[model samples]
Target: MALDARHWVAPAWGPPEQWRLVETIVPDPGPGEVTIRVRAAGMNPADRKHVAAPRPGVSLPVPIGYEVSGEIVAIGPDTRIGSGEAEVGVEAIAFRVQGGYATALTLAAEKAFRKPAPLSHAQAANLLLAGTTAAEMLERVHARSGDTLLLHGASGAVGVMVLQLAALRGVRVIGTTSEAGSERVRRFGGIPVAYGAGLAERVRALDLPVRAALDAVGTDEAVDVSLALVADRSRIVTIAAPGRAAEHGFLSIAGSQPASAALRDGIRGELVRLADEGLLTVPLSRTYPLTDAREATRFLAREHPGGKLALIP
Candidate 1:
């Protein structure tokens, strides 16, 4: 059976203003595929920035989202998800799939996993990208129990995950945030240090020996402070500061990079397990209607929003 769906697409490389919502038919799952009735779609910077301009090997009319949480409405023969055989009516989450900002979609079964009962659809939709990225950052720095990890942008989506994950590993986190965001860091078991002029001095005043640094904010101040506080450049990692990483000899990781992608893919199940156990949680600041995607992206780009954002269909 064919299902009708509405989805957002960027017909040309430009800004969110250029995106359009169009209706299409979602076909039944082919071999190794499953059809999802989307409950919520995860929003991330990459959902917008990746197609903002023409890039090599990318085609136009690109789908706008990469992750979602939904229910399996149909399953193809030979299809299997991480939880075992795919079945209709089971709640599930999928990541790294195209055209997620839709009422429904059909994607490869491997991209879908059973949703953890502890997380709502909105929270599940927003999980893997930030969770996997946070896990990889911790691994890159070899963060372990008894080590102090300096986390920049500590109150944002990835930063909050880092704080929580570091806590699980028994790693002490001194997270950088704005004055308004301090309590969020503290709530997640991080020592909040405000970022700005004299930022390095503020951290120095903490008097704890910094073991490694993780940068979520790609600012010069963040880079300079990490360099000043941490003696081992290899122990410092950045998701936002690739240029700075190249210039300063520090490490950088992105989902587009082969090594980073492999590491994230390998650990998706572990992160889900953590969420299932209630040790990890996604803090949703707000959710927007599916049609309000453009407005939501604009808000995400311009404001902090204090936590993860999602689009409900």
Candidate 2:
């Protein structure tokens, strides 16, 4: 069957202003792939960063978007989920898909998982990347039950996931956030501490031993506090600041980092189970129509919504 779809594309590496929405033919799924009718797509900072400076080897006119939640419309040959047949019309969430900012797209069957019934399409769309990142960082730091860790930017998307997942593992969390976000941090079972001047002193005042630290904010202050509190440099990881890793001797797990891939691929099914069981929750800040993507990017750039932002396709 032939399919046509509308999608946003970046004509070249530049600014978000350069992206244009246009019509194109949607390719059929190849072997081991399935076609999805996208309902919602999650937006991330990387979306704009990639547009501003395209990744190496990616040419112009690249489609934008990384994660989406939708329904299976067609399945390709040799596609099977866990030794079973693929089911059409089943809602699923897929991440790491190329060109997810479309009305429909084809994805490897293994890369998609059934969406939890409790989560809205917008929430499911935003789940995978942040969840996987959290899983990897926790693994990097060797986080375990009875451990206490400091998490910077704890109210943000990835941070929230880390906080909740840590809570599930019985690990205590001391989370840093703005005054406005403190309540949210607390809601996720983190000990909320306000960020900014005297932040290190405030964490010190807690008088609790910090076994490891994860920086999601990439701020100089966050880095300094983590360094001061966590004695082992190897236990300190930053998802936001890869360049600073060399100077500080801490681990960095940015996009495409080898240390992160295994956990990301291995943890998706578990994350789905956790979300389905009510142990993991993704908050939706707002949803914008796909056409308002530019506006959505602008809002994300300027505001700290403390939750996920999504685009309805």
Candidate 3:
């Protein structure tokens, strides 16, 4: 017998009204897998897109969430994660294929990792997706020490992580964000440039040319300014706006690909190590209970000006 919880259902794609809650069965762990009792989940911008788009044969009435933090309560065949080892009381962040928002989920051991020590469940909840995305993009683009990297949406969750990591590597990071988020950019080791109205000129006035660019903001302005400032098109990548990236000669980051698993795992391990060592931090805006999943997903779809939202299950 398995337990059940609120699983979100999206019958159609119009607005948030599509979400429906229904009881769903939790499954047992398989080989190399572990069952986690979800303690928290993180909402991402892509979750809203998936709910509205409802890709055919992909997922539906699907419990939507890619990132979650939880404890391992069950271990399965070929289980290296919880074998003869003590109970995994440490919270962990996970990236999943489906049903991440549920009360319990069974997933591969590598898809999850122990949470960074000292981070609350809510703080660690948002790190898996956003933090790993930043790490991968920076690596491929090679934003290095003494090289100027242009980043869009510097105040966002992923944007801030990129800035901090690049800064720690001694890279020259210039960022574009709203006026309200300028101070945050500075605090995260970026030179804040206003995102609109002469945005390109403002960056140029800083007396530095962009060596590479990464777009987290999914805006035309971000692509245009990156093309204007950076010389190498291959050095430009977009985590958002993949549909238009080809036209602008920017690299589309295909995170859904299988290779991303290795890269994401590499980054996750480093971030966890850094956090455990007390060298890194994650910022959160607000947290909602699992019963309020609709509210969390709705807010994640809208413009989040402060930080990432977490769901405590």
Candidate 4:
């Protein structure tokens, strides 16, 4: 059955000011692809960055969302699951190479994973990008039990996941967050220190020897404090600053750039396992229907980088 699809598109590059919701016809799944009826789609920082500039290799009038949770509604040849499974966190981030912001999307069969039943549509939607980033960064640094990890932006979705997961691995995680989020950080088994001015002093006051740092925040203070404390530049990874991170002598994980399928799945599986073990969590600040995407994006930016913003279809 053909279904109507609603999608967000930007005819030109700029702010979300260019966003327009249009109705389009559902396309058939091609060979090795299955169409997903997107129940929820999670937003990411890449959405804003990509929208700011039009580039070569990007399809025009394309839809834009990275993480998704949905059901298989149509299948191409040689597939197993046809429909009706509320597969959680079916990622289409690389689908960003194609697109994901639509009521329905055709994804390579190998790219879709069954969402665990323990997660809600929003929870599943929130898992893919942030969760995957956290897991990957931890592994990159070889963070381990009994190690003390200094985390930047520990209250945000990615930061929270990294904090908790590190703790679960027996690593002592010290983190930077606002006073408002202190309880949440503490609950995640991390010691929360305020992010600005004197952050290094506050962190060192925690009385733990730092082994490494993960800068998910991209703040100058994060770089300064982490570098001063950690000593080993190789163990410091920054998710935000691909250009300057290496210049500043730290490792970088450019989520805005291409990541390997193996790298993607490594974090995906670990995040799912963490959720199953009750070790992973996300702060979903709000959800908006697809029609209200502009408002969703604006609210997301102002919510001070905590939790997640999700679009429900």
Q: After superposition, which runs of candidate 3 have C-alpha atoms over 4 Å from their true positions?
A: 82-88, 259-262
Question: How many clashes in candidate 4?
Answer: 1
Clashing pairs in 1: none
RMSD of each: 0.9, 1.3, 2.3, 3.2
TM-score, ranked from best to worst: 1, 2, 3, 4
lDDT (tens digit, per residue) of candidate 4 on 178-204: 998888899889988888888888887
Error of 4 at 59 (Å): 3.4
Candidate 3 per-residue lDDT, tens place, 142-249, comes to 777899999998999999999878987899888888889999999988999898879999988999878999999888888888888888888998888887787876
Listed in order, each prediction's TM-score against the native is 0.98, 0.97, 0.92, 0.90
* 10 residues in a row with least lDDT, candidate 2: 77-86
Ten residues in a row with the worst lDDT in model 3?
Answer: 81-90
For TM-score, the strongest prediction is 1
Best by lDDT: 1
* Residue 48 lDDT (model 3): 72
Model 4 per-residue lDDT at 95: 27
Which regions of candidate 2 deviate over 4 angstroms?
82-84
lDDT scores in order:
0.94, 0.89, 0.78, 0.75
**Candidate 1 lDDT over residue span 128-194, tens digit each:** 9999999999999999999998999999999999999999999999999999999999999999999
Off by over 4 Å in 1: none
Candidate numbers sorted by lDDT from highest down: 1, 2, 3, 4
